[model samples]
Target: MYRVLIVDDEPMILKGLTVFLQQSGVSIASIRSASNGEGALAAIREELPDFVFTDIRMPVMDGLALCAQIAEMDQKVQTVVISGYDDFTYAQTCISYGVKEYLLKPISKPDLQDTLRKLIQRAEAAKPASAYLSVAKMDEWMAEIEQAIYYMNQEQVTQLLHTWEQEIATYHMQDEQRIEMLQEFHVLLMKKLKARDVNIELRPLLELKQGMSFHTVYQQFTGSIQDTLDSLYRRRKGKLKDPIEEVKIYIEQNLGSEVSLEEAADLLGLHPNYFSVMFKQMTGETFVQYRTKRRMEYAKRMLGEERYRITDISYAVGYADHSNFTKTFKKYEGISPSEYRQKMGI
Candidate 1:
């Protein structure tokens, strides 16, 4: 569902409009009111709604200033202005600030529905490509780019080209600025690729015509780089660590709780079989083995204190049953909790 925010001085208008929009099939994710521009700015900073509707003549901050602030935070947000009259000059200013549409004070239900439908349709269509550009892929891609900058590998150039192709196919970008950006990226890649001990390859330089602007050329190929990179990262969601490291950390932190291999794998977003194999490959020990080893270490420390009962120590380090803890401890440490405490001279 698309999240939309409304900012206006009129309380009745806010509530009536919110009710109308909600009943029209749009989930009014949040309906916030701001008597002035400062309040709207605070709300926008706090929530960052997908779509924002506000009046042009709010006190303290006004719609124009709010548009500027939102633009700084996220240029993609769709801003719609609400005004009492057809003020062309004011509309021009809002348009310059990237406002999508302006609605009169008495907003018709049909107009709101049409505008909302267009926004939802656009978002739904973009969701699939967005999913593919997941956070993991973006981090990997950024690493590859940094690697290319460091090692100047032709492979990085090849990989970058592949990324551009994927993003271009997904996003409908048809702007001259985008074209110029792509051209600049190509030139940069080519320059970096051919760097031989701080000297450029004369052949590539000669290929550039005398009339061609290097900056414009470079921009043409790199224009889509930012959008593509963004999509790639958003799809992956977050940085990924070694699956074994994740499991080890979780086990150590939750030592007093029962943990299964399947649960560990699920937390790491991996299948149980794959995570089991991968964990062993990376750590050279099964999940249970490492968990047991750590628990044994904690048990030994607790036993040294001698103030707590054996059963207390058993549950302290994640064992639910005292008998199971004693059995495992004896099997791994060659003594029961009681004997271990005695040896520690408690």
Candidate 2:
């Protein structure tokens, strides 16, 4: 005979849940409803309910804020968050507030019934709740993990993970709780990798194995994160030493010559078409555009120096025709070479 309160902004949801629970054959001593968290808090002040089923997004106050208030006002009253969002951060926040359950929206009858049954059984047994990590502590750990990943500090990450496992052992966390925490940590790791443009598929790494020890699972998780960072580092290092980069250097050194795509590709032992596509993808510009831009930049610097005549500067930048060089320079710089030199007071 547990008193229950359902809080949601939707009138349909509030009415539907109330009716469904009332007829579910569960021993709900009394059921109440509120349009939002504010109303729910007001109702609780009037008469504290044994359980609260709340929607995460509601007017005036959200379910997370309500859960925090409940934790402070009455730790005995259990809460179950119902939300459409499947975000791991939300689950982590709710768990920190001692939320008994988190049910996704479009809630099924069986899930609701099962959640209710578990809460009722706990209420009947009168078992004391176990201590869990505080929200602030969990946040601190997450920030440390993020910082480790940002700097690719594998040693720091491994140490932090080992410390986390020890914490779980100290707390005597249940199997379900351990898995949930790991899953949330996996989400954070994947998010960090994605921010750095590491596009590896994470599903395989995130899957929890059956009958594996928590320490083993955590080691594997740490390995996966390390593997991703290693792969990204290797790829970046390889790019610096690759033939494509050599081709770029060659282009810069021969800016005064007729640098052709075919010649550059041949130097790298690649087909011209393939090299063209790869260069565009990597540098975000065509080979001709890059060469032309570089040549124009060099021309401007030489013009400012006034060491050579305009005709000599034009030939020095791979332009054999003075009229053609002036036309191209005006196209890119909005002025002829002589006009640019005059403007620069050369």
Candidate 3:
């Protein structure tokens, strides 16, 4: 919704306009009454309304003069002139100050509505394409340019970049100083990309100067840089997916009471059956075999401690039954757990 401010000398006119506007489609954020141009100017500065409707004649400053001052204050404000006079010359003069609509006094409902509608449409059209730089309005266009490079929409990047380059060409920006700063920024970004081993090459600085708006061009450059970073991240992640290695790490960390294939599969977010097949394919051993190997490795470590019994060691590595642990260990190592400990001199 566009924010509108009604400025007029007469209290009745202000109230009538406010009430009429409130009933209309427009959302009136503020209704300000100014007996003269000074009050209106202050209100305009404070609220920074999207649309300003002012009577042409007022003390201190007339609507035409006030419009000029507002134009200087912010070029984007939409001004509409309301006058009792049928003077075409004054209306033409108002036009020079970029006044959108000229409405006669004792404003009719339909006429005011039509005038507001056209004013709104024109205000929207005159607005800068993107709200990002246009609304906040950076002092140095290059600052906006740099920010746009990182966070703007993907499609607008190219067009904005082109516009910025053209602006740089025509603008009397101190070539040596701006160029130096631009180089430093570009090199810094290049270094960051290089440190991450991102393989894509950024466009050359000299090649970026075809755009009219500096901010637009820089936004495009930054957008491309972000895209490259995203692509690199995806590629890096693709090389690190080792399901069997990941499962081994998880199982090693959590092999205790009640450790099960379902638990192991869930840790890696894989179905138990699929995990079982993949584990064997990658490691040349079933999950059951891998678990047994891990349990034996732990058993050896426990044996070295010489403080825990065979039954204790069995349950320590997730085995519930002592007899099952002894049977599995003997089958794999050709000896009982106790005998193996003694033979190994642990």
Q: Give Cα-based local distance difference scores for all models.
A: 0.65, 0.78, 0.67
List model 2 lDDT by residue over 1-346, tens digit each.
Answer: 4689999999888887886675444445689989888999999998889889999999899899999999998557989999999999999999999997999988866688788767776665564445554433554676687657545677898898788777777775777777767766676556544533334324435466677677777777777767766775675563324556778899889988999998998776556755786688778899999999999999988898877898999889999999999999999999888889889887
TM-score of each: 0.37, 0.37, 0.36
Q: Which candidate is the best by lDDT?
A: 2
lDDT, model 3, position 112: 81
lDDT of 1 by residue, 1-346 (tens): 3567788888887887786565453434566667767887777778767778888777677878887777777545788888887889988988888787888878877677677766665555556754323323333454466344333344565667566556644645444433444444344444332331122221222243445654444443443343333433444354423446667889889889889998987786555655675577678788788888999998888788858888898888988888999999999988887887778787
Worst 10 residues of 3 by lDDT: 131-140
lDDT of 3 by residue, 1-346 (tens): 4677777788888888886675443434555567667888888767777788889888788888888888778556788888999999988988888886898988876788787767665755675554312211212343443334333334454555566566455544554544544555565455433322224345545555533355544565566565654654465563534556777887788667556787777766656755675577678898878887887888878877778888888888887888998888898889899888889786
